[model samples]
Target: MTGIAGVLAWIEEHLGIDAAKGGLADAVLRHVKERCAELRVSPQSFLALVERDTTEQEGLVRVVSVGHTWFMRDREQLELVVGRFAGRGPGAPVRIWVAGCATGEEAYSIVLLADARGIPVRVLATDLNERSLSFGARARYGAWTVRGLTAPEREKLATPSGLFEIPERLKSLVTFQRHNLVDPPPRGATGFDAIVCRNVLLYFTKPRALDALRRMRSVLAPGGAIVTAASDVLADGTPSSDSELPRALAKSPTAPPTPVVADLTPPAPWGAEPAPPTKAADAAPVSDAAPREAPAEDGHGAVERARSALDRGDVDEARDLLKAALERDPLSIEGYVLHGIACDASGNTYAAMASFRSALVLDPSLWIAELYLGLGHDRLGAKGDARRCLARGLELHAKAPGLASLSSATQAMLAEGRAHLVEAAAAKLASL
Candidate 1:
């Protein structure tokens, strides 16, 4: 028969709850024993039953999972949200998701703050515990849960009926539902303007936490923000590597638009002969099509200038030039690739990833795009994605016999790409 350790592992796998953590073992043990007693079976048998019966597993999860939270638990985070939304026009649509919203206090707090500031927003509050969600939907809170609020805020938010009850006006702004953070997000939950999942990742193992954070990121709109507890940081205030929140937000969904490369001259037809020079520059006749040709030539020239600037370590100038190049020829694969390189040099890995991905979209066979993309994901602590991209790049690199014929610069890039992949693998192994 299996022992307590076996049962704990089962709980961790099924619920994504690290039962071995402080006090969690006691809580999970108590629930296991309770189930054993009710089922008239031994602990092992109860575990077997839990595995076989989906309802029993869920019941165990509900009993052991924490739902102990109050409104405005992190005032700083709330203030950040308010500050961001304060000046937005009234007609602007704001959507937020409060993941792991235990008993709904956090969800309601967001709505109240937004309403007080005259920001209209819709909040989707989700928890794994149905009982907690039901209580949240009722919008009723005991005195203890309402302790942090100012008297005026409390008075404005709730009507006291034995326990304080949230008014319909505030409650209507939030919708509560049951959700599992480790699983795929529900349909219609994507494209949120913001997602608040503070103080929740601590419950799971690092891998599971990383998975959950990625799921949250998948649903967030481009440039959307995520808030997490300051305690998730290290002594230096940098987020802990084990904590996925910082890594996930590093590549924010709402990245800036792809920069267009500046125009320098009109586009010329391929292999067209240059016009003969005149004694006076103005003596040349102005064709009706000169305006159109000017932009394309200018774009090509800007791309060349950007590459030169990049070679000179002038990332800012390179970026400016590439912006104009892309603006002139949005489909220019070389422009996007060079822009990605500039972004990487500037330490903007997120923007670099976006730029590289855009290049790949334009030309999937671009040799170095996957390499840089993998490196970007590696920096973000998305090891799985990083490994996948690197592997694909390496595979393509292996099949290309023309590497020997490429320019010295291209050959150097291939060497650098391989080094990055090797370093990433080493880092992953060291962590393990």
Candidate 2:
């Protein structure tokens, strides 16, 4: 890890932000370079200073992270919470926790809606970014943040001082705190009626995310549930009321799952694990067996064991298992994909690309392989390959519904859209 890669890793560590997602890698590199020029220091020196200085780390993270949220961002979810409260007799004020409450819009929005229905509420809003917490604490915002509300609604809720300021009544109902979801919950952070953690967990690594979800679950009152973005697919056990949320968590390309002793869920994404290899060519017996009671690599369960290794953060094991799996099932496209993900995880760029290339050799039009190859190429500064692969990926998944049809591993890697990845590729194209 050095240069751009090292800095991106640092950002992911300190800020708990996925620097690789949604063109964030390019953004971080550009920001660091510009900051280096402004500060009159080399990139290496700047990173060193940031490593030791808490203030610098916070400042750098503030500039690089994205929290593009607004009031009533998901109105349906809010309504669901408010309606639940209205049904209950007066006992305790509805205690709502707005985890990752960016800029406080969502927090304040909760209060305003509850008030409309004459339900009392108290809200605790938290985020990892200090800058965002500071902004939320101000209780003021630009008009663009309130675009969801009509003019009459906006006027009723905010004071116009060239900026939309929430009235003190609403502001007093909410408290803003700086918090990293990866860490344990703030002391005594418990007994919440609702937890609105939307569009936030998608960036977290699997282990860190599960930890956060566990903490959030501890704070929930009886019958209280978490409302998350549709895209977030949490691991099994922790429950949420959001019907749109996926039942099982999938792998994020960069962050594999933490080790679990017993994982009963099918090891494939959204219950769509690849079928047993059909061709006689694919029936080649597994040459090398993995540790423990796991079956040989050629078996269907080989993918399952590899997925298990990923859960344990043992990419080396995963890579080996995938290798034997692919060897046994030469025509298995998903085998090649899993192999590529494991190779990428182990930082073997050449082997990773080969795995993806092998998939392409099998089927030139495979969107999963082409898309990841482009993302991996962009990260390693292969601009030409990134541009070509991403263009094809974006064209293949142009339809909204098709995105969901991809395997779990592919979906997890694609935290955002092909367009987002393509824009980063385009940036590299311009640089070239």
TM-score of each: 0.53, 0.54
The residue ranges of model 2 lying beyond 4 angstroms of the native Cα positions read 158-162, 234-432
- Mind giving the per-residue lDDT tens digits that candidate 2 earns over 41-123? 88888788778877666555544433344567656556665776787788778887777775688889889899889998988
- Residue 111 lDDT in candidate 2: 91
For residues 1-432, could you state the per-residue lDDT of candidate 1 as single tens digits?
A: 374667788766755666554245665676678777877898877777777887776665554543345667655457566667677875645788787776788888888788778888888777666666777898877554565577798676554343567888878888776667667665456666677776555556667766766666666665565665433322233442232433322322443211111111212211211122211100000000101122335777887777777665456567767767888888877788878876665444555677789888876766577777876665444688877887776566557623433345534544544443444333333332
Best by TM-score: 2
What's the residue-level lDDT of 384 in candidate 2? 86
**How does residue 327 of candidate 1 score in lDDT?**
83
Candidate 1: where is the Cα deviation over 4 Å? 1-3, 158-160, 233-432
In the predicted model 2, the residue pairs found to clash are: 258-311
